[model samples]
Target: MLDYALLAALAAVLRTGSFDRAAQQLHVTPSAVSQRVKLLEERLGTVLVVRGQPCTATPAGLRLCQHVEQVSLLESELRDSLPALAPAAAPATLRIAVNADSLATWFVGAMAAAPGCLFDLVIDDQDHSAEWLRKGEVLAAVTASAAPVGGCSSHALGSLRYIATASPDYLRRHFPGGVTAQALAAAPCLTFNRKDRLQANWLQAVLGTVPSPPTHWMPSTHAFVDAALAGLGWGMNPEHLVAGHLRAGRLVELMPGRPFDVPLHWQQSRIASATLAALTRAVLQAGRAALRPAAAA
Candidate 1:
């Protein structure tokens, strides 16, 4: 028999990233949270959480959290089916991680359509959002990873195409000659953040060895494109975002025919529940309509 209180403590510490915050959430003292975690570690004979400013869970800890989440989901299902056991609290909020570009483009549309349920949206880079799911920070995620999380299922949403683009004036000033590896080394570029490698990846695909150009970080998806249109820097813009500009000859493609592809997937915990199912269905339907079926032009 596992001690659920201790398990809850472990989950809270991992989720909140601090014992103090976990204690606040659990309506207990920080000392109580610490003691429960310590006792749980002793009982299991394995350390679950590594103490730090923002704590992280070990593999064993993650497994335990997953189990707790599963049990909670099952209980929710049972409660929903049996109205007599209904809780006084509001509906459980479903937390999910999503990348910025998707949110800026097609993801919000899906979310907008998914009404009547509470959502806690976690924004992160597409490549790394899976780590949130792995750590049990989110119940679901839209990630570039094809490999599913431990207890989650994955469904392909399709490829998000990116085009290496620059405003015509910026290109003329930076590369009087055609886009070449030498010219690329000198031009400033726009990036979402330090974690964003879309620019680097696109440059590498074209230039063999990547260039080290100074970058202006515009973290917002809309701001990132706006910076490019303002001739601040060249960056990999989402194909759809640049389509109108490209057609109007405002932005020129570095590689006219070849576009970078990032295949996205909807990954969620393998629990069957009404809310999760409805959310998944809405996401898949919207994604299929919005994203490119393939990388090609």
Candidate 2:
């Protein structure tokens, strides 16, 4: 039989990333938290946490943490059904991975619609967010792939449209004649990070080949548009984010009428819990309102 108290201690330590923080959150002494973690590790005969400034969980520990979180969600559901059960001391935290672009654009609306749970968001590239789910690190993800991760259900969230934009001055200076392949090779572009492929993908789609352009690695989604407006570099900016700039001539499309639409999906574990179902409904509704139809994309 599992001692839920020991498991809770381990979960709290991992979630807070420190024994001291865990102790504060659990309303226990730091020494007690440390003792609980050590006892649980001894029982499991494995090193669950690697002690450091900010402790990290081992693979086995990660699995246990995930289990604890899922159990919490199940218990929360049960409490709702059984009024006799005492309410939890704190709201459950649901960890999810989402692309920065979606977070800057429409994901918050989905999050806001789902109440009664705190959220721990992991921002990653849309193309890679699903990896968090596959690793059991996140309960749900906003991903570019339509294929469902194993044990998870996928929902079509529609496409987020991107426009390849730059300041008018930068375009004139970089592509004097037009947006030609040769000129693109000489242009400087904005990349979100090493994992970012939006600019490259846009290049390939419009030019039929990718260019090794000089890059300015700006990681923020909003900063990408700011950099473009300042002529730091041309980049793929979200349509909704840059629509006003485009209309005001503060930004111009590199290729007029050629918008890049990246289709996004919401994937979550197929647990028969009301919490997940409620979140999924809110996500679908928000996606419908904010994104272009999946079929249209």
Across residues 163-269, which tens digit of lDDT does each residue of candidate 1 receive?
98889899889999978888888889998998999988888787778989988988998887888889999988888788999999988887688789889999997
TM value for model 2: 0.96
lDDT of every model, 2 decimals: 0.85, 0.92
Model 2, stretches more than 4 Å misplaced?
none
Per-residue alpha-carbon lDDT of model 2 for 1-297, expressed as tens digits? 588888899999998999999999999999999999999999999999999978999999988888888888888888889979999877777889999999999989999999988888999998999999999989999999989999999999999999999999999999999989999998999999999998898889888999899999999999999999999999999998999999999999999999999999999988787888889899999987999998843
Best by TM-score: 2
TM-score of each model, paired residue for residue: 0.76, 0.96
Clashes of each: 0, 0
Misplaced by over 4 Å in model 1 are 1-74, 294-297
The number of the candidate with the highest lDDT is: 2
Per-residue lDDT, model 1, residue 13, is: 91
How many clashing residue pairs, candidate 1?
Answer: 0
